[model samples]
Target: MSDAGPKGRTGRRDEAAFAITPPQIVGPFYPIRERPDLATNLARPMGSAAEAQGQLIYVRGRVLTPSGKPVPHALIEIWQANAAGKYRHPSDMNPAPVDPNFKGFARLTADASGCYSFRTIKPGRYPTAEGEIRPPHIHLTVEGRFDRLVTQLYFAGEAENLADRWLNAAPHPDRLIVNLQEPPSHLEKHAMVADFDIILASG
Candidate 1:
């Protein structure tokens, strides 16, 4: 019901707890437990392709063009690391318990003001090949009638942003960075406010 805001001060848990009733999505992309060791359990979800259930990371933002106008009806897709910093991909080898019910993928269609919100979790930091560590970030896929884009959003003030070899090593930092804003005093303690405006090409 609550979570620490972007500043991590604590209000409500900044995530969605799987309950019998909640707004759904293309969800259950990972598992919460291992069914039988060595099987690599697939615990995403066991229903008709329902709306997903992400971990409740409050991703509320406006999608705007370089001119600073919101793009209505923008389709946004996201993929992020599990709580343990491990991806569901075959390559991730962090050795953390992956949630079998999490699919790691979600989709949202933005509103008239180019605003969108996603309920996910604060992803964990993880390591990449060549011994390079990566900061906490979220991958975004955006599409509109006129433009389409794919990018990532990195936490603004994370120590990992400075220390991690991957972020610093990026050829173009603008392509994969996001600013985490402090929530209003009312929500200052409830949920984080990550303001990311999707940069789209000229229509």
Candidate 2:
């Protein structure tokens, strides 16, 4: 049988569209400990009296193939510093106070439609080793059957983004920046929301 289908119909042997998500440094601080229920929420502990400090924000999106098909059951891991720009880890000596209620790490599994969401505080910018200010960003690690990607998601309209070494080095800096918008009517009144879809290369 010929590979091409009659007319314009898609054939069974049609190639899958793919766009590999660019990789980035995993950074020095990945969480060593794992929580039993990391996928549900990151805002507060099980019974913490106080909510997580800083501006509340909801980060959500889908995992999709380059063809625009959702990749269900994908695992996404995220970690970032608290609103004060200090991570909870001992290695972060940024001199910013860390919020005791903020865990700074979360794991999420994409649903059947490749959708996932998590609540977290807006991360604060911190200084890099060279004394340059690194823009506020969330580190993400996505794992799928075909490939794994490590990248960071930066907020839009940050002045520091212009000088961020890692962001400026990316081949497509626009893809890494996410815009924060007002939450939908169904969500909390004061929360902001950001959608960041991750596209992976086909296996």
Q: Who wins the TM-score comparison?
A: 2
**Model 1 steric clash total:** 33
How well does model 2 score by local distance difference test? 0.82
TM-score of each model, in listed order: 0.63, 0.88
Estimate the Cα RMSD of every predicted model relative to the unseen true structure: 14.8, 3.2
Question: How accurate locally, in lDDT, is each candidate?
Answer: 0.58, 0.82
Clashes of each: 33, 0
TM for candidate 1 is 0.63
Candidate 2 C-alpha RMSD relative to the actual structure: 3.2
* Candidate 1, residue 177: lDDT: 60
Report the lDDT tens digits of candidate 1 across residue range 1-203. Answer: 44365335552332222111111122222323333121111123344154223333466777776545678988876777866777776656778666665555556688898888765666777776666667777776678778776666777777778775445555555545666555677552544666666657542
Positional deviation of 7 in candidate 1, in angstroms? 38
Error of 1 at 196 (Å): 1.0
Q: On a 0 to 100 scale, what is the lDDT of residue 156 in model 2?
A: 97
